[model samples]
Target chain A: MTTAQHLAEQWPGERPEAARRLLLAAVDSFSSRGFHATTTRDIATAAGMSPAALYIHYPSKAALLAEISRHGHATTLALVEQAVAGEGDPRARMRELVEQFTAWHARGHTVGRIVNYELRALPEADFAEVAELRRRIEEAVKQLIEEGVAADLFSVAETRTAARAVTSLGIDVARWYNERSSESPEQLGSRYGDLVLRMLGAQVD
Target chain B: MTTAQHLAEQWPGERPEAARRLLLAAVDSFSSRGFHATTTRDIATAAGMSPAALYIHYPSKAALLAEISRHGHATTLALVEQAVAGEGDPRARMRELVEQFTAWHARGHTVGRIVNYELRALPEADFAEVAELRRRIEEAVKQLIEEGVAADLFSVAETRTAARAVTSLGIDVARWYNERSSESPEQLGSRYGDLVLRMLGAQVD
Candidate 1:
């Protein structure tokens, strides 16, 4: 097997750095050139290896994209889940969710782009898999909104739409967010959290 | 000039139906295969036209892309400008913007996709030209939010970010929106408008 082929082998270990290298390259190429536009060769070259080496690590370009998309969505879901699973009123939990979400996207916008922008490019089965997880995330947000409505924290004719709007605000961070901009990611997150809290009529401070 | 050249010459205007036919083919090919992965032949074949015929209306693939992108943005701006220009309360105007935006994307989804998803393909000069109009629309939203804040009709820190969120939600409508599954575009627009207004804290009947 080629050197590229050798690297394609997944060792049974944490190997965080190697995984990070692979994911980072995948995200850059995926966002810049798109899924179909990018090639395994391009990704491997960018990762400082031959395409064969990439295959040893990744079976195909679709697989690489799926891995990245899966990780990114799972990460966002984890953060969001953690944010809302905490103690305090539903409003407080919602604030935490917003803060975590905005901060994550602000700092790592590319991850969001990879997760959301490339959703359409995923192969049908893979797309369905990712969609299931995305639906989970959406449900989390939906539940949060429903809880807020139940608590009289948020008044809306349709909790589903409210959930979608709030979720869209958060999901969109990946598209227009910039970490190097004037506002720090934390500051931006807090600001957005404030807005979300107010919108929901949650007690601030 | 070849038929491709002819397509370029009459493109985007003279033959309205043909323009849309070619544009739809272009959107699918561009989004799926991307500009480089796709060729004039790919689009021509998709449009069921000779490559030369495709060129007759579009000078080059890049030109074809630019035209589609231009039409999408311009149409959006026109719709918003029209929707908001009428005499209505700021809250009403916000609803109008959301309704018009969602409807436009739902109806002109392919155009929206090509406009948004293909930004990177645009040459630097072309990119800036298209992006400027998008920026202006964004700025207009910011201004609206700021006005709401000033008038105590709405409350949100960082009008700019709220505007970003709002625009982000609307722009991404085409990315995942599907008409076949369920939910009419008007319903989505109306529902989206309702949520946006509530988020903005507009206490309207």
Candidate 2:
């Protein structure tokens, strides 16, 4: 799929067409101009609607951000959860997890940037909801590392720290990856998967 | 020194007192509220000056951000250069480089966040200047990995990818780190140092 196709897929199909357009426009504005910099009028104008029409779908600019943040976090959380549920030993699961996680961030980097970097811009209640999703995401990775250490497939001194490092490897890809980037998301993900496996001290294939 | 003291040291000592105050205030506001959201009036008030006074120090908000970006990039570039110049083989140098680099990010995360995440907010000319500094920083790490590979101290399939992974590990620290974090900069840096060594396939001490 094209980059634009991938970004459009991030929002749910169940939402109304107007709401979806507003969300997509918000993602573009928030990612490029940042959450604090982007105005509600800009988002409405980009969505080809009047400011009054935007309020019908989302009450405030912060509400629009909160919805976008919710969608992005939920999508990534499901991605990690699926990776964890896949068939494999700890080493295999980890490779799959890192590769898919890295590729997801790289492919949908616009949403990734907003989800990862703009959390602080979220309102207090909205931030708490997203934080819960993040905690679950981290726990899934940590559990995989714990399983690896138990099976003697990987040697790790601190599983929590190792999990953080592994996730950081993928999350930061969004910050740097772009059209000018040399590697495709798949190629970058593959390389990062191997590097993360090595970091975990697993046997490289 | 306290975190506040460490943050203050990021600005050069040679700058005049009022300019330094304006710069520090800008860092605090920009980092917290973000560059797009913060007003010159807010920065001036935070610095205990009128908005007119801020213009005397920085002609515009973008100019203030550019100055902060310049100082931050120069500081980190010098950091990597110093580590690369230190004693021992590539393994030892890589350890020192990751340790110090990671610690710097964790300790000065406020400035680190602005420097790393807010680059897109910079004007065209300023962005190009900071990009050059970033290129040099990446080259410094890549050279150390190349040295390690040549010396048979480290094993790597792709030198460039590995260097990016190593730097990403440290740079992401600024995103998650805060007072609530469990590890001190030193402790976190030591762990990351070992992880990078492992990722490089270097002999871990």
Candidate 3:
């Protein structure tokens, strides 16, 4: 009955195949020519369809942006949930999250650009979906920090700030990371996890 | 002299006052509408000048992008130099650098978008300028980490990774930072610095 409940119902069956193709086209066009420079025709051409046909899947360029943005949030949230739900100590949980995160970004590199830089192109309604998901992610990390605080495992005075810093640091890896770089995902993840733990004032053992 | 050196000598002037209005226009259009979406007409309209008249001031859109990017990098390198130069200790210097970085991004929020997100849009030559400055910045942080390592004030085994992590964290703050957030610029700066230092294994005093 609630708005959230209604939206939750819609998310599951949102034309997955059509949405995926449309999103892929949007990402390719936007990342190459950028959001402002890219036209509906570009996306349509990339999708091997007409602009009108594209509209059946996405209402507008903004809608296409929102679709990609939503996908970004959904993908990250699923991975984080899987990483955090398993049994492990707080430190171990953090390492698992980082490893999963690095791998996700490594595998879905274009999604990084969609999530981080292209938000401005989204219409207001579409932007809210990504923002809400990003907030959920922030809350998840903040909850972990709160748990650490409750147990006196970390020395952070402000769990909120620590959560932002930790999350931001990991999220940023998506921006600059290149598989061509010398560090493997596992190596990068371990090293990043070590530093993230230290950022929390936790022992990195 | 080499062609690169000749090109350097033939480089356009850096008169801050002369290009202030044009640069401001570029930043606004670039961030709001994006690089490719924006046109000389948009910029000229914003500056109340003819597009052709604007050309007399700068060579091309690519040239303007390069100059803005060049200025951004120069400002960053200079700030880090000043922040860490003749400093008390590595911890203090890192804090100073973080604080300065957060403030700079806050103040330059418009230009910040183009500086952080325009790498893919940059022509090969322009990218080199930005990349060179980015390298200098990483080296600056690396120097600080090495100093801390030499003093046994921080962990030594992963100084290179630590340096990358620290630089990446600060560079990334520009990407998602919203001034509307509850945290003030200084507060975010101090908190981010704390995390950066922790990641470096810096001893808190």
TM-score of each: 0.87, 0.97, 0.88
Model 3, which residues run further than 4 Å from truth?
A: A1-19, A203-205, B1-18
The true-versus-predicted C-alpha distance at residue B144 of model 2, in Å, is 0.5
lDDT of 2 by residue, B1-205 (tens): 4667887777657888999999889999998898989999999999999999889888998899899889888888999999999999999889999999999999888888998888988999999999999999999999999999998999999999999999898999999988788999999999999899999999655
Candidate of highest lDDT: 2
lDDT of every predicted structure (CA atoms):
0.73, 0.90, 0.74
Question: TM-score: which candidate is best?
Answer: 2
Clashing pairs in 2: none
Q: Rank the candidates by DockQ, best first.
A: 2, 3, 1
lDDT (10s digit) by residue, model 3, range B147-181: 88888787756877787777777777777666567
Candidate 2: C-alpha lDDT: 0.90
Quote the B-chain TM-score, candidate 2: 0.97
Rank by lDDT (best first): 2, 3, 1
Query: Which residue pairs show backbone clashes in model 3?
Result: none
Provide candidate 3's TM-score on chain A: 0.85
Better of 2 and 3 by DockQ: 2
Q: Is candidate 1 or candidate 3 better by lDDT?
A: 3
Model 1, which residues run further than 4 Å from truth? Answer: A1-13, A16-20, A201-205, B1-18, B203-205
Error of 2 at A15 (Å): 1.4
- TM-score: the better of candidates 2 and 3: 2
True contacts kept of 2: 0.81
